[model samples]
Target: WLAKITLVENQVLLKYFVISASLAGIIFLKGAEGRICKTFSAISRLSNY
Candidate 1:
């Protein structure tokens, strides 16, 4: 039935949204870590100088 099809489509869309959001979160976390590492390295170099 049309109603069943709509429900299935909605579920698929919801799953896709969840997966994309999780991926975005992981990317953001990695970016933050990279920034922190770069900052620490810079501080170390400055201290050495």
Candidate 2:
């Protein structure tokens, strides 16, 4: 069961990594200079703390 749980956790981590990468790509393509990008960056910064 530990192995199974580890596998599930890995899958979840991979999914989130993919989502983050996609969002980053979109933000980069959008130039990250837009208001929305700034807002997102601010939110991420807050979440970091």
Candidate 3:
């Protein structure tokens, strides 16, 4: 019974870690996308000149 409880706890911890990691990844990707969009806009403006 003790082992079963430990197993359940470990699963919960693993799920928490996975969710946090996914959120971090999404934030990082969004940051990178913003930078890329800014760069593209700058390049387009320069070409227009």
Encode model 3's per-residue lDDT on 1-49: one tens digit a residue: 7566787798998999999999999999999999999999999999999
Task: Point out the worst 10-residue segment of candidate 1 by lDDT.
Answer: 1-10
Top TM-score hit: 3
TM-score ranking, high to low: 3, 1, 2
TM-score of candidate 1 on Cα atoms, chains taken together: 0.60
Give candidate 2's TM-score. 0.53
* RMSD vs true structure, all candidates: 4.2, 11.6, 4.1
Q: Where does candidate 2 clash, by residue pair? A: none
lDDT of 3: 0.94
Global lDDT scores for all candidate models:
0.94, 0.88, 0.94
Better of 1 and 2 by lDDT: 1
For candidate 1, the lDDT comes to 0.94
CA displacement after TM-score superposition, residue 1 of candidate 3 (Å) = 17
**Residue pairs clashing, model 1:** none
Tens-digit lDDT string for candidate 2 (1-49) = 6666787799999999999999999888788568778899999999999
